[model samples]
Target: MAEQLALRGDEKLLDLGCGNGFIIEELLPHMPAGSFVGLDVAPGILQSARKRLDGADIQAEWVEGSADELGRFQDSSFDRAIALYMMHYVDDIDQALAEAARVLRPGGLFILGTDHPDSLGEMHEVHFKALRQMNDVPSALFKSSPKNRISLTNGQEQLQRHFRNVRTHAWKDELLFPSTGAFLDFYQSHNHCSASSIPGLDLGEGFFEELRCRVGHQVNQIITQKGHFKVTKHTGLIICD
Candidate 1:
């Protein structure tokens, strides 16, 4: 992702939904003379980002705002803009993209990092299977990944509306969890073993506990048989200009 940005050591950059400044910390070194603006809706997240890059010798601004509304920035105010792994949460994808385009200079790049709908197929397979066995699983639990709204599969068509050229760079990789505990930690931390799909399901704490137990049993079986449980990641970047 840092390489795709093609930073020139001096460029005004905007990071939409810049969580914890992870991406900024990595790419800031390459742009010593450049300035950055990190915008997010969460004040707590913005604070974390500020602390993460506290002592850095660079120009950085943190704003609490939504991606769909960029009135804080003037037109052509940025040389580069990025929306990484957070577009699905935007209330309006088109509005956010349009705002990104409005802020970037002519010929500037907008790098969108997102996943394939089936990116974590292995995890979802086990997760859904376990949900199916449960007595009263919410039907919404089986719905597709939220990323499907603007994933590598359909990002080009959406980006084409605002950019003259849209290019997709894709890659695949796998994560091998050697233990059921390790995989369970990952599963629980992310999407709560798919329980997050139905935000309003109102299932109590006991419900998640049982769901985790079932999912863990299946993952343990896979690890026992294959020495490791594998998770495939299908992800890509849609670079626009």
Candidate 2:
């Protein structure tokens, strides 16, 4: 967004669907006083965001709302808007794009950062492999965006349909771990109480222990064969007017 907007300290910026307000923290420092705002539906995440500031007088607004549907705010109220890692969850991509356009000034830009649509393809391959081991065939949840969900391919069109000069810039990174232990913390970053490798299911102590044993056995075989397993993750950006 900083690249697309060429942001300055005085610009009024909005972080749409600013989950956990991580971007807000990074942005607030560079922005001029009283120039930044954040919008998200998750109030708890917003509250956690407040704690990140340590009660320092912040020059930003936090709105508990959905970017997919901006209820208030007059047209052309902001200089720049950001939709980061969020377009994949909206219910109405077109409506969200229009609403975002509605809140942005004539020359303003809406920068979107999302999971690469193809990321799902890669995930499906890995997840289905794991599921098959557990004898659980993949379903709609793994195929497409489920109920109350969205996708990057559709999101690209939605942005172009409502705004002029829409351009997508790709940003990708492949995550590789030498050992599962390197990514266990990354995996734990999921929403609390959300299980991993086992879904709609629980792997009790014995279950995890057996998994550890089995995986360990596999790792030993790899060591003997001089091989390592690699996992990959990808993300990208879409800039629109």
Candidate 3:
């Protein structure tokens, strides 16, 4: 995505949802003469971002804020902006886009990176089926929610509302887990695997443990046959002017 931005080392840049400042760290050298602003709602994450930029000769500022409102910045304050892997967390995406358009200079570039809705593909299908065999998965899981959804079509349409010459790029990769237990631990930590979220389901006490055991067994079977449990990771980016 840094390549797509075509940074010339002098454009004012904004990184919306700049978690831990990792992207900035990677792009810092490319834009040595450019200034940067990192905006995020979490202060803890911003603190980590500051540490990442510490001792660098880059001109940068970290702001604690949300994308839906970037009032602290003046109109056309930025020459480029990026939103990476964090749009799903936003409730009012339209408002956020408007804010981006407001802050960006005319013809400025906006690059957004997010998961393709088909991410994890059959891996999640098999996982969900395993959950249903033991007990009902939450009805909410099937319902559309920004927190757990993305679509290339929807993403392009949204970007078009505020940008021109919108184009999409796809990225694919593979994630391998040596053991089912390891995969289970990672998923449970980042996703809604807790039984507490599905109380009305028929699952009884120790529901999470049972669900974990069954799903782990299913994944382990695949690992035994394939040597490792692999997940297809599908991600995409939208670049607009």
Candidate 4:
């Protein structure tokens, strides 16, 4: 991401949906003479980001605002803009992109980090199989990754609406889970095995318990057959200018 930004150490950068400032922290070293504005809708998250960069000797500001509304920043104020892994949560994806384009300088680059629709195919495969085996499951629960809203597959077209040039840099890697517990932890952290994605499902703890057990069983079987259960990550960056 930093390489795509091509920071000259003095450019003003804007990070839309900058969560906890982890990306900002990593990129700050490249922008020693630069300033950053981290914007997000959650005040709690903004506070967390401020705390995370408390001692860093960098010019950084945290703003509590939505990505679609960049009224706080003036036009052509940023040399680089980024919406990393958080564009899927934007209420209005087009508006957010427009706002980003408006705020960026003429030659500014916007890097959007997102995953392919089938990024974690193994995880989804095991999860759907478990859901199918279970009784009385909500159909809405059988949905694709939320990132599909702005994924590598469809992001280029969306970005082309605003930027003259849109390039996709895709790469793949596999995550090997040594045990069922490790895989379960990864699964639960990602929307609780997709249970949390469906609105108003009102499923009880028992449902999640059973779902986890089933998914864990599948992962365990894979681990026993192979040395570990593998989850392929097909993710990429959509760089626009």
Candidate 5:
């Protein structure tokens, strides 16, 4: 995606939903003479990002704000913008796009990465069953969370409304888990939904431990037959001018 942006050495860039600065670290080498601004709503996450870039010898700024409100920056302030794996959480899609268009220079590139709604079909099935067994089904757990506003089917149309020459590319990958416990750990870390996030799911001291036991048994049964379980990730990138 850094290559797709075709960033020059001296351009200023804004990364919306720049969570922990991992992407900034990766893109810094591509833009050695460039300055970067990382914006995210979470202060703790922004602090972690600061630690990541503390000694990187790069010109970077971190800001705590919403993606839909780029008013802090002047019009046409940035040369390019990126919203990777995070636009799904924006509350207002039109407003966020307007903000991106407002702050970016004319002809500036905006790259948006979001998940396909149908992605992780198998993982969701397993999670849904486990929740049902525990009688802890929250509709948001099955449906995408309230913040998720974009999907593969509508991504192109959404971007075309505000940007020219919008195009999309699909990225797919698979992850293999040696055991149910290992897979559970990965899920807890990477997925937006987890035991702690389920609304109204009362927690006792042994809640997750017991839930893991049940889900683990089921997962182990599958592993016993198949040797390992795989989770597929489906993501799409929208590149616009």
Candidate 6:
């Protein structure tokens, strides 16, 4: 939303938790002369991000650090800041928002986009059962955890407490696979509910084969809906002053 919210031609923009530098790459055309900085905690992810935009030819900087504590920048140094899929992982939401406000100029805007609490249950439809079955464990193993949707209510409240204005929006989308087996395989690489985030997520040996069989049996009953599965999402904007 930085481009939509009037990120100027000369303003310095900061992207918090900018996974793989995707936004910086996409915003290159609009910010040919503007400075873009991407911040994330994962060093490996940042390395891959550098490769993603290797030949973009636009000026940008990628740093491995916490957005909640911009170690290198002075107060009120940035013209705009955006936090995408970030607040949930932060230990201190208010402090993060305060840091955003600290780095942003008085009139500058700080935007935040995070997964809605409602999306947590919906995401499970695609991968949770397999997450349990793959390990040959009981369903109760990980029935209660906030991997994809943590800090549901507190996050929103904290944003409101820190930002001057708050606005909301809702969205939903579907993930398609050729078959249920295809989906199980994809989850190996793409599942958001990792073991560390979810308690008792121990899928023992022969995970792939077992998960595939279970998913196929259930998927065959519902073919009219096509190969895709729907995912509901909600997001809001915290306009920092």
Best by TM-score: 1
lDDT, candidate 3, residue 130? 65
Candidate 2 ranges with C-alpha deviation above 4 Å: 120-124, 135-141, 145-154, 188-229
- In the range 1-241, model 2's lDDT, one tens digit per residue, is 5656677667788888876777877776667564777788889988777677656657767789877778688889998888877665666767888888899998888888776546534334443344345433335323433312434555567667888887777655665445655434343353211233334655456644443344444544444565444445455677887
For each predicted model, how many residue pairs clash, with residues at least 3 apart or on different chains?
0, 0, 0, 0, 0, 2
Which lDDT tens digits does candidate 6 get at residues 1-241?
A: 6544575577788988888998777777677678878889899998988899888776678988886677588888888888876766766666778888788887888777766555534445645665655544555545544424434344556666766765554355555555655655555554434532344565554654565566555554443466554434455554555
Summarize candidate 1's per-residue lDDT along 157-221 as a digit string, tens digits.
99999998899999999999999999989998786745764656788888788888999999999
lDDT tens per residue, model 3, 63-176: 999998898999999999999988877768888988888899987999888877777765666556666786455665554435354356578888888886889998799889
Tell me each candidate's TM-score: 0.96, 0.78, 0.86, 0.96, 0.91, 0.78
Off by over 4 Å in 4: 197-199
Candidate 6 local Cα displacement, residue 25, angstroms: 0.8
In model 5, the Cα lDDT at residue 184 comes to 80
Off by over 4 Å in 6: 120-122, 126-154, 175-178, 196-205, 224-228, 235-237
Clashing pairs in 3: none
TM-score, candidate 5, is 0.91
Candidate with more favorable, higher TM-score: 4 or 5:
4
TM accuracy, model 3: 0.86
How far in Å is the alpha carbon of 3 misplaced in model 6?
Answer: 4.7
Q: Which of the two candidates, 2 or 4, achieves a greater lDDT against the reference? A: 4
- lDDT to native, each model: 0.91, 0.63, 0.81, 0.90, 0.81, 0.66
What RMSD does model 1 have?
1.3
Q: Where does candidate 1 stray beyond 4 Å?
A: none
Ten residues in a row with the worst lDDT in model 2?
Answer: 190-199
